[model samples]
Target: MLQHWLLGSLALQNIGRRKARASLLIAAVAISSAIVFTGVVMMRSIETSMAVGFSRLGADLMVVPQNALTNITAALLTAEPTGEVLDADLLDQAHITGISRAAPQRVFRTEQSEFGGQGESVDLIGYDPGNDFTIQPWINERLGRPMQPGDVILGAARDVPLGSEIALFGKPFRVYAKLGRTGAGTHERGIFMPSAELLALVPAIREQTRKTPPMLEPRKVSGFLIELTPGATELQVRFALLSHLSGTKVVAGGSLLTGIRQGVTALLGGAISLVSMMFASTALMVSVLFSAIVTERRSELGLLKAIGAKRSQIVGMVLIEAIVATGGGGLCGVVFGMLLLRLFERSLVYYLTEIGVPFLWLDRMDTVLVAAACILGAGLIGAIGALTPAWRSSRHDPYDLIRGEG
Candidate 1:
């Protein structure tokens, strides 16, 4: 026990003596660990956000005009503008089996200048409040009251303040509530209101454009939001809709966000590959650094052996020094990584949005796990790096090393 204590003290003293070199090694490990931590946390966040957003959407399928399928999908997923209109009477003509509820929506694009510097055009969704199950729950949770004629609800990403009146088509509408971040689809950038109010605004819009009145005629809808009954599958409802509805395309909810999911998956793959490369490079650096340190301290190790120190003790001492350096650095890395993620979160989201990918930051539990994994991984790397150096030093001939020939 005394010998072990002496060996530990010697190792610590040696680390203190080479403080600058030790700090460099620690920094290298810390940087690598930080990259890994951030990548894992961000990827997990994206997945979780998608799951939550999809759950909240609460739709089993979407039915759109056959020619407007691509445009409608883009509008719903990426907030892109759509010009397609469908006959609202299609709801009466098509009755899908196992469908418990359906809501029709009229989609339009707000003028670019009306966004108050948002840079991107906002999608305006007009829904029948009485028939809507999709947005009603969110509205109830957020506003606690039914939507009035002039009320508008903004999506998660809108910077508009609650109760502020925003002008659209020469008329002002009050912002009733702002939706929570959904992180997956167009709800993050949409403005929802009752279809009657949206239809009423069409005249003003036409007057502003100097076109003939009634550009958006009454009873014209863009798409249908569908909900299935209990024990009914989306596939079953989809087939029924396709069989009953003519000139319309029915898409399952799971298939709606395929493009965005693919993009996120690609981004995650690239991030993982980059992090793996960083880990490999960091491990190689640690190995090279410790090997040099071992070569430089050959005489010291030899002196300890001559004084009856066991080979295992020498190996343990080297490993302890490496671990101590890396462990401290790993903790710092975790902190740095979290800070980096927070600082760049908005920018990251914007970039992903531009590329049409979904992005989300990790929640508390995920962040903690990422930090722990990074710190532990750093320690493991340090131990592995020290192995070769420790073994070489332990096997050295004490006589030759002492005479400066080892």
Candidate 2:
């Protein structure tokens, strides 16, 4: 134990003695590890974001009026307004072969002058809270209460305060809660209210628009959101719905996101490839750096050998030095990477949204695992880099090394 302690002390002293070179090695490892760590975390986040986004969308299939298919798709995916309506009774068709759940929804446009200093037109989604699976999970988690008649929930992008009142069709509705950010989807720019409330407001809406025809009808809705039973494929449910319901079009939600998923997958694949190349180059650089360090310390190693030190002891000492440098670098790299991710999270999300990609932060366990992998991989790389140099140095003839003859 004493001998091991002394050797460790000597290794640490050598690192201190060569501060400049040690710092360079440490910095190189840190930069490489940071890149790898960031890439891993971001890739995982993108994947999770896509999954959660799909879940939040709350449907395996959507049933819309035959002529309004494209318009409804645009409304749900891009937050555009749709003025189309379908028979509310169409929701009954969801009880077909493979369907698990279905909820009716009515979407329309409403303008509020009190929001953001100027009048802004926002998409309003009226849903059946009792039968809803989509958006309800988030609402339950965030608000812990069911939505009531005159209450509204704002999407993450809208600048609204909870408990504040906003007029819709000349009636005041209190803001219930604000949702967390979900980028570039209908939820980001939507305000959700009870379908019953929206139905009640139709008369008032007609009163306000005396010269124009009413857009909303008492017993009509815009679409039906559907979920499939376990072991049931979307294709099966969609086909069944199509055959059962006339004047309606059923679309698989997965088909809507296929293009976005392909783009994100390509981006993640390229990033991983780049990170792998960077790690390889970093390992090579570490090997070269340790080789030079071993050459410089030839005399010191020789003296240790002269004092009856075994070759294994000499290798252990070099291994310790390499671990100290690389481990420290890896830790710093993790911190740096996390800081960068946090600082640029919003900007990164915005840019990806513009490019039609989904971005989200990883869960705690995933983040920790990614960080641990980066640090451990870096340490292993450093140890491997020192192996050849340590072996070669330990095998040198003590007398020749002492005489500076090799």
Per-candidate count of clashing residue pairs (backbone under 3 Å): 0, 0
lDDT of 2 by residue, 313-357 (tens): 999999888888887788889988998787668587778788966
For model 1, residues 1-406, the per-residue Cα lDDT tens digits are 9877877788789889988998887888888888888778877787666644543555667777776635333223321235666678876776556776678887676554255654457677777877676564444234566567899988877887788889876588889988766564567678888888887777787776565222157867778777665556667777777888777777666544433544555676788888888888887888888888887888888888899878998898888887777877788888888788877676877787688554556868768887988898788788889888888778888876676555
Q: Which stretches of candidate 2 lie over 4 Å from their true place?
A: 54-257, 345-360, 403-406
Question: Candidate 2, residue 320: CA error in Å?
Answer: 0.6
Off by over 4 Å in 1: 1-4, 54-257, 345-361, 404-406
For each candidate in the order shown, give its overall lDDT on alpha carbons: 0.72, 0.74
* lDDT against true structure, model 1: 0.72
Q: Any idea what lDDT model 2 has?
A: 0.74
Best by lDDT: 2
Candidate 2 colliding pairs:
none
lDDT of 1 at 12: 82
